[model samples]
Target chain A: MSAPAVAYPDHLRARVDDYLRTLRFPSRAPRTDGLEDAMRYSLLAGGKRIRPVLALATAEAAGVDAPDVLALAASLELIHTYSLIHDDLPAMDDDDLRRGRPTCHVKFGEDVAILAGDALYAEAFQHLLTAQPGEPARLLAAARELAAATGVDGMVGGQFLDVAGVSDTPEDLRRLHALKTGRLIGASVVCVLLLAGVDDEAVVRWRGFAGELGVLFQIVDDILDVTGTDEGLGKPQGSDERHGKRTYVTEYGLQGARSMAAECHRAARDTLSVVAPAGATELEQITDFIFTRTS
Target chain B: MSAPAVAYPDHLRARVDDYLRTLRFPSRAPRTDGLEDAMRYSLLAGGKRIRPVLALATAEAAGVDAPDVLALAASLELIHTYSLIHDDLPAMDDDDLRRGRPTCHVKFGEDVAILAGDALYAEAFQHLLTAQPGEPARLLAAARELAAATGVDGMVGGQFLDVAGVSDTPEDLRRLHALKTGRLIGASVVCVLLLAGVDDEAVVRWRGFAGELGVLFQIVDDILDVTGTDEGLGKPQGSDERHGKRTYVTEYGLQGARSMAAECHRAARDTLSVVAPAGATELEQITDFIFTRTS
Candidate 1:
């Protein structure tokens, strides 16, 4: 899980950041003043932007140009943002802080937060639906994939299992994490492949690789919640254990959880070898970063 | 605003009810155990089934057979049910009761309720996406329309405005209700038009008619919320006022609101006459029902 520090070249990272900035809320209609500002409040609050970065990096790795993949990458990030807003509502996780700023509901009230989420989700699909002329079918496929990943059988379903106290076994834990975190990551890679017009075999292999990476990400996140500092993490630490959450850190002890995460990262890197043989060096670098990231 | 009761015929109403029951939750996959049950809980919780009924009735009135329109009608209802479930979450309206029973989140946990809503929303499109192959484009159009209506610019946006607190201006009040309540109803009629495969100028006219009817229906709902009793309405009275919501009744006095509703109902009836010459009588009957209903 360890590799040399290979920072994303400043120019490429800057372009990714620029794409993210364009993904913020559109200005509100004159009749609906303040709506855009509310939406932007949560969206602009800093975080890794990992999902979009994954989309772009994978698309580039698959030979798609940066300009061709920017919208798709932003769409993935919008979907991720919407999920965070809804998840933080008082009914769900009820958190006030997200990314070291007030959660959507806390800043704009639950109604606006809910609407903001709905808007972001819709905008994500709209972005896909109205993609470049030659990209309609691919966009539609991406939209369908995203809808399935975020809806009943995916993120929402995983949340249900989590809150229902159903993730008692390792299999249940895997199912929860796969749907909760893995599907979006998987879809991000799949979207890149679709955009790049990659072969089905490569698409499937990439999805498998991304899914493993997603689970590893979640496992590492759980570990961070226990071992990381609040300043470093940008959100509360130890809340998972406090909330009686069924994280890997809770199900397995700290050392066991660390070992499980390392194994997952190794499996992810192994999967990536088949999917991106030409980009294997970069994939390994990402794996190493995920394994060791403090936040 | 008043008219004598005109039966829809027991056979027709019973047929629609039966169709709704079957469509409540599509047969679940083995892994979707609790998801199926959570969806069914609210879908089966009886209301007038107004949205689905409106869809089916409009289709039949436009010359499509009721059975032929069943899936489309059911899809519309699923969206409505999903909205209700999400709306009742503790983060939203937080009502414990709906349709004389405990709300989904009250009966199930918040997470299940959220999943149920997401599943129902997903299933609505899933049903449309997998519709019988007669009119794939129409199905796709309807799915897209449903997505737009339920997302930010329609129901969700209206909800945002509602929660943000509107002023006493009549126009502001109307805008709020139009989004919150009118759009889904408009979508219902649009679904019928799409499913019926109607392409005449009549489609445009009926959409206009349905949009006005949706506004009228919402105004009547506001009046009822303030004036109707628990037994008649199946929920608490004045709940909107209790929440400090700005409704038609709040912005205008009772008499003023009633007069506005009457005018809208008449306009709706007039538009229906232009759109559905064959079904004008039935459409007018529905308008009358909306204007005079206790709930």
Candidate 2:
């Protein structure tokens, strides 16, 4: 049985929503055309701004001002948005629905959609460079984290492996998830740690915690695809099974997958316990909330 | 008529060729998945290697050692290669031929091509970080320059404008080329200035000179696409015209475009005259070489 839904503090939820709103592209002149529209449509489409929220919340939990973390948070959102746009392309996942609306390609032409995604991905760094006046070193560090997590050795590499073939073992599923979904989510938390000037030991602990949390999140996502209604998922259900895509739950029986998820949550909690510095009550609450998300 | 072809210095040409060969990915075991083969194929499908050559030659002209500039030079090639891969994708330019060979997507499957391009782009930063043991700050600056040139306000943005409409006026075409092809090439020259630790005033002047040279180079390319023979051009001539793409040669007639190209080249030479320090004969050679290229 799952734990009851945790009531996220209203203030934090509102903050995330507001940030998402601010991320939309400013409207260009009438003749400027569909590129900006496609970018805004996908970026501003309602989804749980979880990754950016994690970055912001983690930074705040580490005692940095929330505004100081805003640009980094936005950069995370841009990376996430780019991935979604690309994944939904005709050459890739080719999905019609994303966040309960037509995907970027479905709404705009394929060529425009591709360019929009590329623009957003590039704009992420442009925004970072100009976002807030900070140490150039810190800004570069943030840019590196964003690039490394999204580029070849991170999410893209995992996608390649997933498309090529999955290893037959359950352990292979774990390793794949550790790269595909885990790295970027892990980077979100780590970005906050670096921004807050956390010690190396604490960063390691936080990254480990986030890694486990990411795996748990992926497993939960797989489970939801199998069991949840279309309305609940905001997209088609059973996509993993339909596509014959290898997933954690596919390798492990339902009961086994559930048990593994529980283990991951426990490991995550344990790692978080090690990393949470003094006065980290909010961080603890956020971890608890992660364990309770249903979709 | 174009100016007579100036003989390029034998040593510089040989060094560039050697650098290109050494930069090819080794087809060793554990990496024999054929992805490296695809990357190597594209990297070796030689164009002028203008960008990397500019980087290395500028550094040398600024009195920086060749060894210190190798990684930076190679990083520019990696970026150029990655951009070519994406530009040739079905959704983008859809060109079957690049540099007289089947484009990356034609030789490699689209999925592998996408991943290969991604790997090259990511490897660019990895190479910069690891290859040169120079000041970390310099490495970071180089990476940032590359990123800015490729990002939204740069090449990506220009591509966006290109695909979104041909409704652009002559002025819009100029702006688009400045970003699309000009930015990265400009960044290539700027990287050497920054790496050589040139004074701010000198760096500023070189950047302006490089930007003008890039625009001049692109305008000449547009003219060549329309006027040059298929044998000389490698790819089919007038492909851009067939696509209804608005180019300088499209907006202005052939004669007008040729005159504009010459004017741009002259302006570029003037800028270089102001920026190139004493004893920089190689820089003058590059200016002449740009004007004489048939393809």
Candidate 3:
């Protein structure tokens, strides 16, 4: 299942940004009007492109040209972006702002926002179909991974449980955030593996890395919500407390949660050294990006 | 591409009903409590199971046993049922009842109903993973077909266009419904073709058959909505007129719409005759069932 090291060469920042700007989503209906506009509003609105960069880096680390998986890589961001849109729905989180801009529902209206999210979800899978016929097996594997990550067991289920306010304790909070925040990030890594033709044993090791990274990502987010200000967040700070939701910070206290985040981030870097290629510094950088981002 | 006269043996009524009763959805989330129940409420609360039976009958007509594509066939129903649940949302059609029972949002809260629809949509694709691993190409082919059909160029695009009320005349209506209603129905036929390992030429012919069948199904729906009673529809009649949405029935009078439905039925039956095997009578019967059934 292992492969000889071919160090990842590129940063992937430029390549991922270029792909998102250029890729044309396949739409046959003629009256696209504002549908495309609504989708692009959030999709292209600039959120650091962390998810796709993770996928692209993973592909590059596995000794494949990241551009070959560019469409597949960008799809992770689309799914992530769509989840954010749906989560901001008036009926859901009721968030009126995100990414330093108006939320999708606020910008495009709730109906269009919902439809945009649904469109993005379906298009994420549809875009993968453009993978060349020679890569059918790997393509199928990636698509399946994406679905399982975003579907009921992952993002959707996590949102459902979160909105129902079903958690009672720290363990419940850990389990909830693991599914809610963890799965798609895990999927982004797995998409890279399958697309790069990595083996299941290697995939298992990378999943361990992604699991730690995902929790680290969420914990940092909770830390940001508590410590950052509206000027930095583009929304009010202390939102978790406002909603009376128990995040990692709330459960662990500021100092304890910071330690937990650091521990998880360290575990991820350690695992990366094992699963990644020799001199695969890009992945480690991305791990730090998820761990240290303030907004 | 022409198949001989093999009739679609067995009514498929009992088999499809039995399969729907017994098939287990692939859901991993533990706190399924209300989400699963809402999905089942609309799903198991019976309709004719028309779409799935089409896939099965198509499989059977191609000379394989129907159960071979059971997962694929059942997936079509899941998708169809999910679309119905979404369509009946208060922000959408706002129907209170369906099939003589409460609509999902009416029975469940709007939030849960939305979640249920989202769950069903994801589960539809997840269920396809159960298809034969031995036939990776066919399985991938089926999944891709479903995704494309319900995706931007197909169902999702159609729904967006519909809600925006983009149609100006009859041709616009046909184009709208072709995407909205046609693609999934078309995917049902394509599923049977790929699963049967049929060639491309046969697939084209069956797609034509499905195109006609999809329109026939919709025209019949509009007519039933205009003329049927609450006892038959399980919801208030005159929904299309109440909404003032354009339809075949609205675009053409009742007599004209009925003739259009019959014409579509004949065209579908005619195309099926060329595409079906020597004794494929069951498909013709199903076509008639779609046409003549009042409910």
Per lDDT, the best of the predicted structures is 3
lDDT of 2 by residue, B1-295 (tens): 3666675554665676687688644211122246567777888787777887787778777888776788877878888898888888898888888888899989877867776776677667656655755564565666667777876657766777777764467767777777778888898888777766677888888888888888788878888898788877777899898878998787888788778878877887788777764656766677667766777
Q: lDDT scores for all predictions?
A: 0.73, 0.73, 0.79
Q: Residues B48-140, candidate 3, lDDT per residue (tens digit)?
A: 677788888887788878778888877788888888887887767788988888899888877777777777777777777655343777778
Runs off by more than 4 Å, candidate 3? A1-11, A132-134, B1-11, B23-29, B132-134
Looking at candidate 3, what is the lDDT of residue B7?
A: 34
lDDT of 1 by residue, B161-224 (tens): 7666754477777776677788889888887787567885767887798889888898889899
lDDT for A75 (candidate 3) = 80
Score candidate 2 by DockQ.
Answer: 0.37
Which candidate achieves the best TM-score against the true structure?
Answer: 3
**Correct interface contacts retained, every candidate:** 0.31, 0.31, 0.46
For candidate 1, write residues A1-295 as lDDT tens digits: 2335445334444665786677544322234455666666777776767777777677667777767777777778777888888788777778888888888888888767876876777666656555422354455456667767776667766666666667768888888878777888888788778766677777777888898899989998999999888877777888788778989988888899889988998898888877777764445766677777787
DockQ of each: 0.35, 0.37, 0.49
> On a 0 to 1 TM-score scale, where does candidate 1 land against the true structure?
0.88
The Cα error of candidate 2 at residue A102, in Å, is 0.7
